[model samples]
Target: MLITIIILAISAIFFVSGKIRSDLVALCALVALLLCHILTPEEALSGFSSSVVIMMIGLFVVGGAIFQTGLAKIISSRILKLAGKSETRLFLLVILATAAIGAFVSNTGTVALMLPIVVSLAMSAGMNPSRLLMPLAFASSMGGMMTLIGTPPNLVIQDTLTAAGYEPLSFFSFLPVGLVCLLVGIIVLMPLSKLFLSGRKKREDDAKSGKSLKQLVNEYGLSHNLFRLLVTETSKLAGSTVIELDIRRKYGLNILEIRRGDLSRHRFLKTIAQKLASPDAVLQANDILYVTGDFNRVKEFADEYAVSILDGHATEETNRNENSLDFYDIGIAEIVLMPTSLLINRTVKEIGFRDKYNVNVLGIRRQRDYLLRDLGDKRVHSGDVLLVQGTWNNIARLGRDGTDWVVLGQPLAEAAKVTLDYKAPVAAAIMLLMIVMMVFDFIPVAPVTSVMIAGILMVLTGCFRNVEAAYKTINWESVVLIAAMLPMSLALEKTGASASISNALVSGLGSYGAFALLAGIYFTTSLLTMFISNTATAVLLAPIALHSAEQLGINPVPFLFAVAVGASMCFASPFSTPPNALVMPAGQYTFMDYVKVGLPLQIIMGIVMVFVLPLLFPF
Candidate 1:
């Protein structure tokens, strides 16, 4: 027991300090437990296969697909429209909308989905995003209180009950408690957020250094040089690969993308496919190619290949207005050459960008001067910002060669924002089906099974761009943290450490009746959550809460609920929850910002839940 307590104490200290990664800290603690012989190998390793962990993983994929397909954004944006320039109204709606979505999505996913939208809306309303961002983070936690799958702590409690031979909670078992949490959060957070978060100056760097796509296009005069060419029936370009044509080398023309239409089984309907122009992409009749080059060179190339120039006067105004260029499959980014770059004096052709980097140098920004055409003979200079275009994956590779050049702005974040809106309907239908399967007991599928089915369906139905994209949605850090920490609970139980802690609690607070004991459990859990992750805290304390309730001759349901609520309601620190930390930088929030706005909310919530749980569960 002493060894177990010492290991847990060291782990808690590291968790609070935040120097080491929490997941790493948990793994070290697991190793200590094994080395101490407090747990067998099977007992220590069981957490990896825990149903709770599996459910969380599946939920991550489901939430990722929902966001990737733009369903969550559409719903939130439409609902936010009702706020209509009223900051107060916007505040209320932010809380309500976040809570509603969070009940279905993980709180981290909920905040991530809503962050950019809320920032955009807050700025449009002429209010600082900070006014709503903190509340947005808090409301996600409150929202998680609404359903069994809403938060990890709720699952921890449910798992505890089932392991103790008690009835497991239903899907909506937390709805009433969740509703209460949402209401309290709304009432308390509105004034607190306004008082503590309003009128903060935006960070100067908040305006990203990278130019927007439209700005880049206009500055480089790309629209004036870009043209569309059609591959007609008699066109020599048909049935030939781009490599066979070697247009870049022979005609100074770059094929940016290819647009093709194919007739579906429903012959009247045509599905349009847009793909990045690769060297091996074979051209066929009726294919429309987006090409960029000098007007005369493009005309000469089209005439030689028997292709028709579809748009003879494709002016900058028309291209900008129509938004002809998209970054779905391919993307563009500007990279500044390092002072010591080996290619500093090399011409574009000499550098062989196409052969080496698989990207095309479309333009160069040398201070105020822009060179859009005749880029092949242009010499690369130090500190020159070259606008390169290629597949998003290839563009990402440029950042890895940091010694040569630095890619500006957040290319990956920009890529993530490109929504697959066409798949929204499919994602919504899959989400609805999963909810139905879980909500209705008449359905034979388990909740975890329903989530797994929904996750796989999301990938199969193309909600995400690819399977790899789907995998990126899961936060492996949080998953591993939970998995590694779960075994600590088993160690505590095996060594009688959990029973001893519960006995101390029962003896200390039992004389004051169950209400005081309830407060003790709630406050202890909440306090611990402020330091470590809420999921880890719940894993450690749940068994103690259960043992305490049993020793007091009371139903463990209320105690378990208290544990869940306390473990989740932590708000006094930004590090307490992922959502809180997520908004800190964007909202320009300081540590005190969270303490001033969140501490009172935390205290009031604990007090309320302490009284409310017993009434609802009838201990």
Candidate 2:
């Protein structure tokens, strides 16, 4: 008992600090339990092959297939267009769209796909990307709250209820409370969000910040280099094509890409400049070109040609040649990395970033509260914003091409038009059917098995263009996290720790009856969700909650519902949900922002579940 207590205490510390990877922490706990003989070796490894584990893998494949096909992008574009461009309109629309789709799909998957588009739209609208990103993330969470198929937590509860001899919940069983919670959450977030959120500056203004780029970079223990050149209307380069631009010969430079309109790059055109049609290809006002060359050459070229270099870099000494720095209405902005970023503890110099990504880390956004200091010398953190300057095209392209990097609502070019395998819809339809069968009891296969089989069928049918893409879609972190944590949960039960904890609660709240039990269950799940993946939290707690029911001599319905609701309330922390993580980069939200909005909502959820669970599954 004492050993189990120590392990539990250690687990709590791991959960709170999140210093080590959660999966590693869970694995360590499992190993400790196995070593102590609290659990058998087989028990320690069983979670790796559990039905939930199997199902998540399959669902991940399906989710991957959908993304590979670009169906999510298609859906997001249509929704945003319909939502109109107003910040408030877009917010509600995104929430509604995400919730509606997420209810039937994977929340994390939904967020990952939609987040890029949301950021793009916010940047286009000249609105702070953060304002809408958080709402969209929250929407994904709420949408999944509605159905058993909506999120893993709901499925866990329904499955546990089934195993305990209770009727499996219907697809919409949780809709009433879920819908209420969703609406209340949105209503509460909108007004309060502005207090912490700031709108991003306009593109024209950002273009004007070019001079300040150097100042920004200097703060990061880095320096910015500026260049100014003219794309004369008569130059063959101007009329011939972007591909034909004599970057290496005339300018002795590298053209990262060009931002013509909102597009990223065009593969068919060979080069970014080539994509512009003959007449329209002429360089017009604000036709900025991002080139990589020496700062001296850039300065000499600008001096000889009489073009403006962004003035943000100029100060007293530099101002002696201030006339040389032309303010061409061009600007640059910096975004900081918060402590949570994977980049934290890693430096741009260490990453071989320039060679690897072909983009310079011009400036650093400090991790501190204000924009006054640059993060140049400071290590990057999760929430740090980077003040980067490159050709608008290079900056945009860099963010998209790199998997490890996320762009903070920077305007970039359009995506290359690639012929998509339209069979994705058919594959998606089939997968949807599988999910429906489980929710409606139209099929006998477990939800996990059904999703896995659907994924296999999707691959077999070529619903996905390639098998490799399908494999890539599975969030391995989530899979590992779930697999690792299950063992520890089982150990807790095997060691009599779960029973001991449940009995303590039962005794303390015995007079309060099931209402008390429900709150404890709900609050515990909610708290866990804040720290770990919702699915992992649900799976880890489900068995324990079920076992606690047996020991307490009560029906497990209330307890199961508690776990269900608890796992869904991840609004309190960015770590609470993948969707949150996806948007946090672009939205520029701080850790405090999530806590401020999510904590209250989470508290309200706790209060509501206490009342709702009793009504839904009379204790």
Candidate 3:
């Protein structure tokens, strides 16, 4: 018992450090318990193969497919479109929409998807992102309360009930208290709550930086690298497509655009140009290719392809037409370095960033200072926002990397990929099938099997382009964290530690009356959740709540609900939930901000849930 306590204490220190990875801490603790004979090998390894873990993996794939297909972005546009310019309307729309989506999806994924859109919307409406974000994080939690799978705690308690020979909660059982809690949360986070948030760029200010793309045409010296080539009938490139030519990879050059008719404006020239210039378009005779590359490769490509180089730079200063090179077609996006990004503490030059990624760093935003120049030498830090520039193809791929970098928002002009755009319906269908199979139990299928089918279908139906990308979409850290933490709950119960804790609660707090016992259950669960994953907290306390109920000779339902409700009240700390972490960097929220706002909400929720649980469940 003492060894277990010592192990957990050390693990908690690592979890709160913000230096070591949480998954690593969990793994170390697991290995320690196994070595100390606190747990058998089977017990230590059982968590890895748990149904809950598998279900989360399936959900991750399904969620990634939906995200990649731009479904979330489409929803963002439709809802915010109706929100108009009123911050109040936008606030309501954001909370309602994020909550609605989060109930069906991972809250972390929901927040990651919405953060960019909300930030952009807040900027457009001239409001600080923090004002909209706090409600967003809170509402996401509330949304998870609406369904069995809304959050992990709901599932944890439902399964716990099932294991104890009680009927598991139905899918919609969370609706009653969840809906009421959501309404109360909405009231608490009204627009007036903005006073507690940080001041940032207003809507009246130039929001182009805070809102959308900031084009820097000459920043990367791309002008000097631009070269125009005229392909003749004898050119080797005349019969090939841009992708087939692979000029970008072969010679380290970016083909900016392809123009046909060679400065001839016969009106048909526009039609001819349209057919031959896009990245997928084929090359033809009389085609003029606008390319950017090193000077040596530019000359080599022209010579090898039997093409002629156009002397002097093609600038809007010289050409007055639509095809004029006036800093157009440049793609720049803001990406924040993930706290766990490997690129941290290293200079951009040291990372071989430009050569490796084929993107140029325009500026770096570290706290208050926006370092535009001298970026290559400056060491990058976690949470630093970067302004990066590249071709549309190169820039769009950055959106796929949710692990190392948090892409702020996509540029307005960049088109969604044809595969992802078209596959949205397929992904939606798979998700529906998974939900129905789990809910209906039409064929007595295991819940994990349905998720597995959905995950497999997501990849098989081209919703995810490849297996590697599908794997990349899962948050391995989250998977490891949850899987590794499961054994601790089992160990606590096995060692009689959980019962000891529950006995203390019944003897000490329980003597005050059932209401006081309810408060203790609620407060204990809530406090544990603020510092650890809510799912782990629910697993630890749900049984203890049941044990307490047995001692008091009342229905366990109220106590169980208290555990669920209290565990979900993870608003008081930034690290309490993944949604909170996702929004912290984007909203520029401080720790005190969470305490100032979330602490009150947590206390209020405890009081409300404690007061109402007995009435709802009838102890």
Candidate 4:
């Protein structure tokens, strides 16, 4: 018992410090107990096969299927359109849509797709992005509180209760408290959010003034190296087309543009300078060639052919060709580092950021300042904003490698547009039917079986683009954390530590009545979740809360409710949840932003759940 208590205390310190990864901490605690012979091998490995863990894995697919079919994008767009330029309405719509959608899908997925849309809405509505972003994140968490599969924490508590020989909470068991929290959060956050929100600068002003071509050339040292030449009648290249010459490879110069006179324009009439020049344009007398490369190469071409460098002029037209758009297949993107990103503290050079992701790091935004140079050597930190240039295909591929990266702003024009997937309604139907079957228990099978069937149906119906993609959506963090932490819970029980802890709790607060004890459990869980993964918090605390109930000779249901509600209340800190991290970069939000807005809601939720759970469950 002393050993169990010592191990748990050490683990708590690690969780509270937030320096070490929770999964690593949990695994270490499990290993300590294993070497000490506190648990048999089967007991140590039991959580890997926990029903809750299996169902959470299955739910990832059901949720991914809904979003993969592009159902949320289509629906959320309509809701925003209905909002019709009202900032208040758009605010409500963002929260409502994110909340509603998040309840059914992974909040990270919901937030990833919604971040750009909400930013665009805020920009158009003439409101600061921060005013709506934090609430959008908070609402997503509240929405997850509503459904059985909303968040992994909910399942952890439910399964923990079942393992204690109690009837598990139903699919809709969380609805009442979750609905109250959602409505109250929307009401309170919408106005209070404005008081704390601030932007680094106006987005519109920054977009308009971003960087000019001449400025880029000066900074990149390209001046005097680019030249335009005119093709004369005596030129060997006259009458030959660019594609015919293969001038790019043969001459070692990238042709920027070709200007022709009105009389000679017929030779190259179909060209558009804004887009890349077509190789089919036939060279003609009086046609001007714009190219950039080593001066020696340009001079050689000029001397060999009947051409003269159009000297003493490098105007705005040339300046306009200075950006990455000048090169084919190059695209720029902004991505925010996740709070739990593995890239944190790792230098871009160390990670081979350029080669691995095929992106050139251009700038870094940390806090309110933007760092434009030496970014490759700067060690990345959580919430560090990165400006990168790469091919659009490379950017999309990078976004998929992990949850650590979230693609910012718009998808590239080169990216496949999110067309209305005709399979959306079918996907929605499959999801709803799965939920109904589980809630009603009408399938003559266990609830987990129904969930598995739902996941399988998603693939068979083509809800997800493919089976491989669906598997990628499963949150391996939650799986590993749960599997690692459950052994600690088992160690607590097998060594009588659970009873000892419960007796201590009862000795300290039993006289205050079940209300006070419930409140204590709720507040402790709530505070822990603000610093740790909510799933881990739930996995560790739910069993203790149930033991407390047993010691009090009352029903374990209300105590379980307290732990569930507390674990889901991750509003007090941005690091508390994934959705919160998603919006931090776009909104330029800081830690205090969450505290100023989320504290009151956290208090309100604590008060209501403590008083209300007993009435519903008769503790």
Candidate 5:
């Protein structure tokens, strides 16, 4: 018992700290259990080939199809359009959509599909996206409570109860409690979002710089009449600097900035050439000059010398309306995609993307946790966020598409891809049908099978373009982690580890009777979930909960429900679930943000489920 406790504790630490990759941690625990004679090698490795694991893989492929087809994107955009411009209404709509989908689809999928739209909506509303994204993540988690197939925890609980000789929970058994929890969560969360989330501040920095320079100009904007010129070797002003040419006095114009290269409209050649030849070096063949505040001065300067006035790419019609048009230089910034982003496992080559939309993917920021070869060519995976770059206009465009990628923050130029056509209603209908099947037991197909079928049908119907594209839609790392952890869960069960520890627990808490025991079960499951994957914790504890019930001579139904609710309510840590991890980068959240919000929510839910579950199920 002591040895088992120690092993489980070590595994728990590894899971909770999230210091190592989850799959690796699970692998190590399985090996250790086997080496210690806790389980045979075959037993240790059995989880990899489990039906659950296979189901997950197929479902992932299907999810990828739905994502690639742009179905989710279409649904999100229409929702936003219907939301009007009200912040309250917009947030509510997002929460509703996210929760509704999350209740039936994968929780990670819920966050991945919704985050881009949330960021876009926040930008359109002139609000900081950081504030909204996290709440959206939290809301996705809350929605996962509604059905058995909503999350792995509920599934674990149902299977555990059935194995323990009790009636498995019906799909909507927890609907009332789940609805109450979801409502309470929204009410508690909305007001705190701004406090925890901040806006993209660099945009303001770019604007400030522009405004400072603009204010110094007498014309307050670029004067079209003044032609900016570059001094070449043939020009009379080629040998002149600011001091030598006395440009301000001679032409009644001040130099705004200097650059080299193309003179295209709005494309500033800010990178000046290096390697000055001499202290008194005459301006070379490519010295750009930005003269401001005077039109005739440009003509006079050009006439006096052989300098070439720069012709902008903007046409004459565009220049005519230039006064009213707000032409801010779209800035470039690097953003890291969070691990929970749906974009993981996808590549630009597959997304039908190119740089025409003003968004450019300059580069990627690969995590040190896992080594990725050929950054651009390598497929994106969970825990591998990206550093993308793009203009605000392009970022907005990408966000509105349903290609299943999340914008981490500001786009790095390399990661921005062209937006594609999305069919929202079709995607929503498919997703809705899958959820309905899971909840109402309508089709009787396995939850994972339903997801896979819907996903394939979406692709066949031209909802998405390619078969491989659909493969990129699932969170493979989470799937792998769940698979690997199953071995550890089995080890825990077979080692007599769970029964020993649970017996001690039951004896220690027997004084409080079944109610206190139920609370302990819920609290333990919830707390463990915050550290380990909820499914792992659920599987490990099911035997223990069942064992405890046998000793207490009461129905295990309430006790089992406690495990399900507890395991699913894992919002307090990033590693607890993918939704938490997904929002971290986009929301710019710290560990404390989750603790501040999730801890209390977990505590309240723990209490509620313990007291209320017994009443609902009867002890």
Candidate 6:
């Protein structure tokens, strides 16, 4: 017991300090328990197989499909249209919309989906996006309180109740609590946000101005380097594969795309098929290759291969014709290098974007200046934003390497705008079916089973672009954190630490009444959550809360509800939740901004839930 207590204490300190990843800290604690023989290997490993972890993973895929198909944005944009010019109305709608989506999706996913829409709407209404964004982040957490699968803490409590042999909560048991939270948030945040978040420099608007495709092309001078070359019957490049030619390596040239004509029975009415250039693509007579390189290199390659240069500047055409850059298969995006990216200080040639990631670096944006020409030998610096063009699949692959760089804005949103919007209805229907299976008792499917089925259906029904895309949606860090921390709760219970803690609480506060005990548990959980993950906090406190109520001879439901509410309601610090951290830069918020705006909301919520929970669920 002493060993377990020491391990828990060390882990808590590390969690609070934030010097290490929370998931790593939790795993180390789990391992210490095993090494101390406090838990068997099977006991320590049980968390990885827990249904709460499985359900969370499945829900991530469901939520990803919702965003990938653009269903969430379509629904959110339509609902926000009602806000129409009233900043107050828009503010109310932002919270409601974010919370509503958050109830069904992960709060992080909810905030990400709603961020741009809220920003655009706030700007249109002449309101600072800062005013709506913080509330937007808060509402996602509030919304997560609405359903069984809404947040990890709710799942922890549900698992705790079931393990104690009590009747488990139904899907909507949290709806009332969530409703109260949303109402309280709407009432409290309006004035607080206006007072604290409204003061921002005029540079805010300029910061939000992300570049468009045409702007990127012009800014990079891609048009100057871009040219069209036609392969003739006599050309050596005809009937050769792109890899066989090795133009990129041998001639310092990149074939960005290819346009070929398909002749119909009426030869004059031939249709052109555009394909993003790939290594395996076969060159044919009359094929139009969209190439980018230095003028001398392009000229030499054209001469060597007997290929004719069709136009020096065919990219200037603005029509939706065969000559323009087609985004159907290929796209361009900006990626900003992290301070620790291995590619930093490495020249473009050494990094080999084409050979390594199958993408072309069109230009680099370093602060105010843009480097467009002779990019081969340019040494990359930290914070350099590179404009890259490739197949959307390849661009998305680049985005997944989060340690090296961050793909700016929403690449999925951009892709959905052109290609995947047709899948929105399918994704919406799958989500509705999952909700139905979870909500209806007669369906005979468990909530976790329903989530798993929905996730598989999301991929099979083409809601996501591919299986890998579905898997990419899951945040492995949070999943592992929750999974690894769950075993600590078992260790506490097995070692009698939970009972000891509960006895101390009961001995200290039980004489005061159930309300005092409830407040103690709620406030303790909330305070711990501000430092560690809410899910981890809930896991550690839930067994203790259960034992406290059992000792008091009152119903344990209200106490457990207190645990969930407290863990989910953490808002005084930006590091408390993923949604809070996500909005910090975009909203131009300082740490004190969260304290000034979020501290009041967090305290008010605790006070309200402490009084309101027992009324809803009797002690």
TM-score of 2: 0.51
TM-score of each: 0.69, 0.51, 0.58, 0.49, 0.54, 0.56
Residue pairs that clash (backbone atoms under 3 angstroms), model 6: none
List, residue by residue over 1-619, the lDDT tens digit for candidate 1.
Answer: 8999899889877765767776788799999989989888999899789866787678778878887877776765675689876777888888888999889777765776577567767766778889988999999999999999899999999999999999999999999999999888988988888788886776664355577776776777766677889999999998999889988778877777887766344332223477667777899999989888888998999899999987575865775433266566677889999898999999998988777778878889999998766788889899999998887788888887557889987677667767766577778788878877765668898777888999999999778778988898887766776777777767766787665664576468866888998898888788767655688778877988888889889999998899999999999876677677667656877667777899999999999999999988978
Cα displacement (Å) at residue 122, model 4: 2.3
When 1 and 6 are scored with TM-score, the better candidate is 1
The candidate that achieves the highest TM-score relative to the unseen native structure? 1
Query: What local distance difference test score does each model get?
Result: 0.81, 0.60, 0.71, 0.68, 0.60, 0.79
Clashes of 6: 0
lDDT of 3 by residue, 1-619 (tens): 7888788878877765646776788899999999999999999998799876777677667667776665555555666679876777888889888888777765654665466567656655667778888778888888888888888888888887888898878888888878878887877778335768745543343343333331333433444456778788888988888768867557767665666543344321112222224345788788778776677888887888788887654543344243244322345677789899998999977866456566667668789776754556789999998877665556667776447787665553332222254455666676667666655635597767877888898788666546877897677776777778778777776777655665576568977777888889888888767644678778888887787777888888888888888888678766577676556655656556777788888888888888888888888
Per-residue CA lDDT of model 5 for 597-619, tens digit only, reads 67776786676667778777788
lDDT for model 3 comes to 0.71
lDDT of 4 by residue, 1-619 (tens): 7987788778767755667765678789888888888988898898788765677677667656666666656565676679886767878888888888777655654565465456656655667778887887788788888888877888888898878777867778888877877887877786688666744455553342334433443444334456778788788888887778766566666565565534333422222222223455678787777666677777887888768877534643455432212322344456789898887999977866655665666567788776654554689888987766555667667777748878665434323222215567776677677656654534586657777888898788656545776797676765666666666656765776654554565457756878888888888778767644677668777877887778889988888878878888778765566566556555765556667788887888788778888887786
Task: Find the 10 residues in a row with the least total lDDT in model 2.
Answer: 270-279
User: lDDT tens string, model 6, 1-619?
Assistant: 7888899889877765767776788899999999999999999999889876787678778767776766666765675679766678878878887898889776765775576556656655677788888999999999999999888899999999999999999999999999999999989998998888887653432343366666666777665567889999999998899989978778877787887765445332233466767677898898999888787898999999899987554565533243555565678889999998988999988988878788878789999998866678799999999998887778888878557898875565566545345567777788778777765668898777988999999888767667987887777776787778778767876887655664576458767889998998888788767655687778878988898789879899999999999999988866577677666656867667788899899999999999999999997
| Cα lDDT of model 2 by residue, 1-619, tens digit | 6796698578657755766765567678878888899888898898789776676667667655555455555555676677676667877877787788778766755665466556556655666777777877788788887887788888887887788787988878888767876877787777766665654442244442333433433454332343333444433343445335433456554432333432234322121122211212445543444444566766655555444455534332354332122111122344445345566777655654445544445445544543322223445656656655444455566556655555654433111111133444655576567757555655676666667677887777655445875685666665666676666655655666655654565456645666776777677777656544577678767877777667678878778777877788678765566566555545655556777777877787678778876776665
Please say which candidate is ahead in lDDT: 1 or 6: 1
- The deviation in Å at residue 138 for candidate 6 is 5.3
Measured with C-alpha atoms, the lDDT of residue 130 in candidate 1 is 94
Residue clash pairs of candidate 3 = 126-203
Off by over 4 Å in 2: 11-19, 101-173, 188-440, 453-466, 512-521, 524-564, 567-598, 611-619
Name model 6 segments beyond 4 Å from true: 84-91, 98-179, 187-326, 331-419, 513-518, 521-602, 611-619
Judge candidate 6 at residue 279 and give its lDDT: 71
Candidate 1 vs. true structure, TM-score = 0.69
Note the clash tally of each candidate.
0, 45, 1, 0, 20, 0
